[model samples]
Target: MYKRVLLKLSGEFLSGDSGFGISPDTTADLARLVTGALGGTGVELAVVIGGGNLWRGARNGKGMDPATADYIGMLGTVMNAMALQDAMEATGQPTRVMTAIQMHAVAEPYIRRRAMRHLEKGRVVIFGGGNGAPFFTTDTTATLRALEIGADVVLMAKNQVDGVYDSDPRKNPDAVRLDHLSHREVVERRLEVMDATALTLCMDKGLPIVVFDLFQEGNLRRLLTGERVGTLIES
Candidate 1:
């Protein structure tokens, strides 16, 4: 249903049931799912993944330097990018690992035109390093990249969460899942779909967002095909 989609993956998801690091099973499963989706449909795909499993930057306490912590986190993302790329390529899917920070030996520099070109050629592009700057989440990087590439929608792949709720479902029994929401509503209600900056960018660009459970089998493909799989936050 969508021409091109940017899939935002969290580092937490890559960590699988474990609280930290990559799980071979989880990474392989994701690679297969995404590659299968590409085979079935002609949707151009890109990815921006978080580095929470490794380090959360400024969020890390104990007076650590924010920029240095963020840089470490960015490097963690590069590790993730390389791992995902390997998995995809192993499954016969052409993939590119692009990074904001130039690591010539590992990933290509994030060049806007080149990235768009890779997408056009049906290669899955993985964006790493959180915009090559500190104080920005991968969520914001996904937003910016989606705009740059003219994506049809941003597919937010939450770990186990199905959608946006009025409160944390894990904590509140009465928390309500919102099936539909506007950008204004998300900001006004202070929903936890993504960072405020990222949502603001989406609002400015008139981009639609789908926040769904990535761990749920076939949910990603279902969301891409316009099936009801998760919360549709847009307009």
Candidate 2:
């Protein structure tokens, strides 16, 4: 069981069936679920959300420069962070949105000590903007924050997949799911569970990661309760 956990949620998951932009209803539902899981447990929570639903750096601007595209993606993540913070607060949960880039009017500049203080007080902290630089993914940010904040585990919430598989489960009916793995094995096998940098960081820090299907009812709660419902990667 984790005393503190960092949840990594992709922005696309917030979009629901629309596949783009934030869906208030869906986000509200997610907020309820998160609050339910956190209620009375006193588990410290931090979140990192992706921006694929709004814009993906790799797919933006078509022929535009890569740096420009990535910047747009970073902006998109900030957008999601603000929305998620609002939704969480609406559910009566005190939440803070911290950005790697200093956007004072929009979010607090990321300060490690302040974030840890928020966690100690049971506030949900949402880290956004993807490292505030180009060529780095939110996955890496999640890993970095998890280690920096001394999180007990990182819960990776996938859209539908339950765990890491040898192959794409959608494409291969026979794809094998791994219930457990070592950090070394995940990297050596080239599994797509997390980005290479994130994987390496977890490995170095001996951080445990849980990969689970976020769409499954009560799975997040189960994960927080220490129920083994998905694959776990550990050192």
Candidate 3:
């Protein structure tokens, strides 16, 4: 089993059928699934969640200042982090919300050593605020945080996408799912596994990324057990 893993969750997964905003039921269900999967596994889990459900920087920055809009999007991720913390705690899971931006009132500051300590203590660390900078996607945050924490792998949990495909699976039914790919191949082909900067960081650092459908029951557990649940992108 992997000793430590960073889980990257899209905000869309927490929205459920509403397609926007956070859904309590969906968060609760996700909390249960995550807690259940990691229970008794002795794995150190850290999470980096996106803010697409509440705010999309590019799409929402139409008439607003780019930096301001991006900061607002970061705050939205803080909201998501809080919601997730509540859900996970409700399931008796110990979780900590760490933000790159300072918000001592709601969450702790993202200090690398402190984050590593939390994981070592067996607490789930949820990173928010998108690396406290503008013009960077959460994908990059996940990769950076994973590297900082020295995680064995990055688990990219998708909403419904089971793996990487040659084309958009929703638009093209004939799109073939690729179970394995090299980081160089992803960068060369411009696959949607993650943003270019983040994928490049992974490639340069040799950090493995596993993209899989989070909604699939037991997929996380299977992956932790080395059962090849979805796409494996690495060196």
Candidate 4:
């Protein structure tokens, strides 16, 4: 059971089968899933979205400067935040899109107090723009935001992956699924949960993390209600 949770969603979740850009149908479906999960639950929610669907700075920035490419990726996340916000609101879920980079016309600037206030008021806060910095993945943004808002835990929602495995489950049928692990084990073993930076931060700050399948019906609600639906990584 958790009071407040920060959800980390990869951009690929918004892209659907195409795996390139945001799909309206897919986003709407995801929106419904998220809102439905929290419908009767009293848990507060915040989200940090990745930009990998629209842009992967390291993979797409062949000749351009890394920082510039990352900035471009941040913009992509803003686009995603707005789309999710629209879809969620249509489902009667009060949502707010806050950007780390100030774009007054599009989103509210990410202010720690303001975000916390929104959550207290029963609004789902969507954090976009990747912490308003370059070279930091959305993973880091999720961890950072979780810390700033004093969230009970960080929920890493994978597209379809149910949990962390000893090896790549898709490529290796023998890959073992790990249900529980220490943060140190995850970092030392180089598990593909979060980036090393994010893991280390959580380890240092004593933040618990849950990696689970976001598309699974009732998975989010179960996790929030203390039902173990996936991997649990913590100190």
Candidate 5:
């Protein structure tokens, strides 16, 4: 099993089946999954959740300033982080909601050393605010956190998709799921795993990524147990 890992969760996942606002049922389900995975032993997990449900800079802010829209998206992520934190805490698991924008009233400031310390104490750290910068997606934030904290692997929890496919599976019935891929292959093939900048960072750092469906029963547990359950992208 990996000693430590970073899990990238999109805001749509927290919105549940409707793909909108937060859903208590889905949030509770996610909390239980993390609780089960951690069962007092296994990988040290850190989460980076997207704000697409509440805000999408490019998609929703067509007439607004690009940077301003991005900041709004970042704030949305913090809100989602707070809800997830509450649910995780209810599970009896120590979890911290760290924000890049320094929301002292709600979340602690993002300190690299302090985050590592939390992980050492078996606390699940959730990162929000999208690197505290505009024009950067949460994907970049996840990769940045993973690299800074020396994570062994990045577990990308997709909402419905099971793994990386050659093409859009929904549009193309013939799209094939690739079991494994190299970082270079992902880049060359232009896979939709992440943005170019974030993918490049992972390639530079030699960080492996596992893309899998979050709703798959026992999939998270299977991953924690070192059983391959998704498309593994490595160096």
Candidate 6:
């Protein structure tokens, strides 16, 4: 269903059993799942990872200066990016970590054209550092990259949940799960699936997004094969 995809993974998802920081085993599992989906297939992937496991610019540093807190959060994302890149490489998948901020020693600077070329050659590119500026979320970055790369869909690999619901399903057991929704519905309902800016960007670009549980084994493969296992946000 999709020749190219942009995968958005929250940093918390990488925290294996401990629920904080990068867990080698968990990252390895995710890498294996991603490679399994793309291996022997001509699918291209670009990954955008969040830093919530380490630090969230808004939630952390309540007393600290906003800029300092955001910078710390960006660094956290770089750390996760490196870990994911290593895990993917260990699984025999070619990967690259590109940062919005210039970090020549650790990653390449974000260049849309070069990233597209890498994808074209079957290399998975992981974008980190969240627009290299304060206030913009990684969700927005994922949407922007998806449009730049002409991805068929954005696979929002969430932790511990499958699909979008009218309310937090964990809290409200009776929350209705939505199999399909329009971007406008997400915005109008104020669903916290993604930031409003990100949702609007996808809406404007006409990019579909599939919000699914990354922890579910083989769910990524099912999504790539066009299985309607998650909430699809489209026109």
Which stretches of model 1 miss by more than 4 angstroms? 59-61
Those runs of model 6 whose alpha carbons end farther than 4 Å from true positions after fitting are none
- Mark the 10 consecutive residues where model 1 has the least summed lDDT: 53-62
lDDT of 1 by residue, 1-235 (tens): 8889999988876677786998878888888887886686888999998888777776663488788888888998999888899989999999999999999999999999999999999899999988999888899999999999899899998766899999999999899999999999999998888899999999988999999998788888787777887899888
lDDT by residue for model 6 (131-159), tens? 88887888998998899878999889877
RMSD of 4: 0.8
56 in model 3: Cα distance from truth in Å?
A: 1.0
Specify the poorest-scoring 10-residue window by lDDT in model 6.
221-230
Model 1 scores a C-alpha lDDT of: 0.89
Q: Which stretches of candidate 5 lie over 4 Å from their true place?
A: none
lDDT score of residue 146 within candidate 4? 100
Clashing pairs in 6: none
TM-score of each: 0.95, 0.96, 0.98, 0.98, 0.97, 0.95
lDDT of each: 0.89, 0.90, 0.94, 0.94, 0.91, 0.88
Q: Which pairs of residues have clashing backbones in candidate 4?
A: none
**lDDT of model 3 at residue 229?**
84
RMSD values, in order shown: 1.3, 1.2, 0.9, 0.8, 1.1, 1.3
Worst 10 residues of 2 by lDDT: 56-65
Name the regions of candidate 4 deviating beyond 4 angstroms: none
